[model samples]
Target: MFHVAALGELLIDFTPVGLSNAKNPIFEQNPGGAPANVLALVSKLGKKTAFLGMVGQDQFGLFLKEVLEKNNINVSGLKISEKFQTTLAFVHLDKSGDRTFSFYRNLGADMMLNASDVNYEVIKEAKIFHFGSVSMTEEPVRAASIKAAMFATENGSIISFDPNYRPLLWSSVEEAKKIIGIGVKLADILKVSEEELELITGKIDVAVGADMLFREGVKVVLVTLGKRGCYYKYTGGEGYVDGYAVNAIDTTGAGDAFLGAFLYQICDMKMDELCGLNKNDFKRIIDFSNAAGALATTRTGAIPALPSIDEIHNIRLTR
Candidate 1:
């Protein structure tokens, strides 16, 4: 059985590398897409993991598949679609090294995933199944996303959701909330930014927002507060973990790294052990994840920024 499996988009993020002589932005292609980044870290941590997604039958798509395979993640469920080109996102960064995405994905390959294209055989054996809201924004792909989540549930795999909201991908805030609510209900665990909490739950406070999700059936709610760290609320527990200090160069995939590390820790424990785990147990997990997230920012790109288990462990030890 696999430790984790994720079903979602796989694409290339063209991030600003530097300025050209003429002051135009110089972009570098990085293999990205949230769920893919999570699985990359999971595989790096020595877990048996697989990725299920669609990509264009082109060079970019081939590059992504190769990257995942090189990370030691199973790609049996990955498909190459001839109908659409691979999705692309041009990332713009602020002075703080934070990013914004302008996508080139109208009817893109990642959005063309049909429910039939999903390989349930791989998902059923996973200990955890992870996804995000980006895949649910469009049709056909939306159905595929829901089907995979349900299939994972029916097969007894844990459901993990990250609402990696990108405003450029949605038509309106109302539509995003309406669709994301469906995923919130399906997930056992959720990860969202403070802005996403307000957007998704209409609650400004982190605890209030988490409480809103709990009422909707989420077992655990993780609010990622960037440099302030992460806030978590579960059935009988709630607390905040302080984020690690780092000289962040690029913050592209930090949240995904945090999530991958958190899930890896969860899967490392027996289910009953996790259930019986206390606030301290949860704290250790979140602390390790916070360090992983912080270290990810010290590097550039998504997959490239992912930290190894030892790297995270050493940081936690020294800090």
Candidate 2:
């Protein structure tokens, strides 16, 4: 049985091909989208995983599908839309390898996904259902994603959400906050970045941001702090794990890698076991996830950068 089922966008990212050139800055195509990247990481960790989303009946769509298959992710729930084009994002990375996105989506195929397109049976079979806030930026897809999360919860599946909070994709920051808050309330596990925490709580302190989220019904809150590692907090627990020191090449998928590892660990344990996990157990899980995120930053791209289970184990063993 698949441990996790993720639903959202699967698109192509055009990253700079080489160092910035005066004449023309070439670009390379990479398979991306937060949910899809998480799916890839889960699969890389030797976990049973599936992805449910829509892609266009285009070459880029084919590329995205191939990427999922190559990573051993089940793509049976993937829908192909003939009327719309696949979504695309142009990613620009500064010298520090920090990224900024310029998206080109006009009711793209990914956002065209409707509730009818979802495979409710597959979602019911998974231990956890994971998603992100990007799909909430639009209409039918937003409704569809919320419906899926609700159904997953009703069927006893743990819901994990990442309020990935891209200001560019949203109509306004206030609107994004409102909608994302709804998602956080519905999720059992919530992942946020430092900037996302500040935006969501208007607080610079991570502890305060996590406390606010816990009060709103989020059972667990993970704050990814890039190089500083990640912070994990729950209703009755709190801790910080220092990140591994690595030569970070690109940080595009680090957060997804971290979330994927965390979800996989939770899914591997029985629901009753998870409910009974002690603070020590939670710390170990978050520490392992933090290492996964750090390793991802040492590589390029998103899906291709995720570490395998053996790699994660070896890294931990050495440390």
Candidate 3:
């Protein structure tokens, strides 16, 4: 059985490389999409992972499949679409390594995934099923994602949700809130950025926001605070873990790497044991995840930037 199975977008990210002699920007293609990035890191950590999504029968799509295979992620559920081209996102980065995105996804292949295209057996065999808000922005794919999540939970797989919201992808804030809330209620493990927490809960305080998520049916809430660290709250325990210091050149996949690392560590743990984890147990997990995230930021691409087990261990050792 796969340790993690993720259903969502798998697209090409055109990240900024540098300027040409004519002062025009140059871009490098990278395999990204929050769910895919998370699986890549988990597979890199030697976990069995699978991806369920649609991509165009194009160069970019083929390249993404190859990347997933290289990372050892099973792609039996990945479908090829002849109707639409692969989705593309141009990532703009400031000096601080923070990023903004411009997407080319009008009727993208990823948005065309139908419920029938999903392989329920993958979800049935997975220990955890992961997803994000990106796939919920459109039609067929949106319905497909929900179906997969429901099937997964019914099969006793843990539901992991990440509200990796991009404002440009949504029609309105209200719509985003409404649809994302569905995933919130379905999630057993919810990972959100600090801004996302405030968006969902309308509260600035981490403690209050986390409490609100707990009420929304999330059993665990992980709030990422870039550079500073992360805050986590579960049914019986809560605390913050400081991030690792690094000369970060890009922050594109940092959060995905963090979540991937966290899930990788706990994939084999039973639900009761997971909920029973004390402060020290969480501290070790978060420390390792924080290091993975910090290390991811040190490089330019998502999957390529993910740190190895040795690298993560070295970073953690220094702490």
| lDDT of every predicted structure (CA atoms) | 0.90, 0.88, 0.94
Q: What is the TM-score of each candidate against the true structure?
A: 0.97, 0.96, 0.99
Which candidate achieves the best lDDT against the true structure?
A: 3
Candidate 2, run of 10 with poorest lDDT = 267-276
Pairs that clash in candidate 1: none
lDDT of 2 by residue, 1-319 (tens): 6899999989998877675558788878999999999988888877889999999999999989999999998989899999999999998888888899999899899999999999888898889999999999998999999999999999889899999988899999889999998888898988999999998889999999889888887888899999898888874478798888888878888999999999878876765576567888778888899889988988778887889888788778766
Ranking by lDDT: 3, 1, 2
After TM-score superposition, the amount by which residue 275's alpha carbon in candidate 3 deviates from its true location, in angstroms, is 0.6
Query: Per-residue lDDT for 79-138 in model 3, tens only?
Result: 998878999999999999999999999999999999999999889899999999999999
**Tens digit per residue, CA lDDT, model 1, 243-305:** 988888889999999999999889866544664678887888889989999999988899999
What TM-score quantifies how close candidate 2 is to the native fold? 0.96
In model 1, which runs have C-alpha deviations exceeding 4 angstroms? 270-273
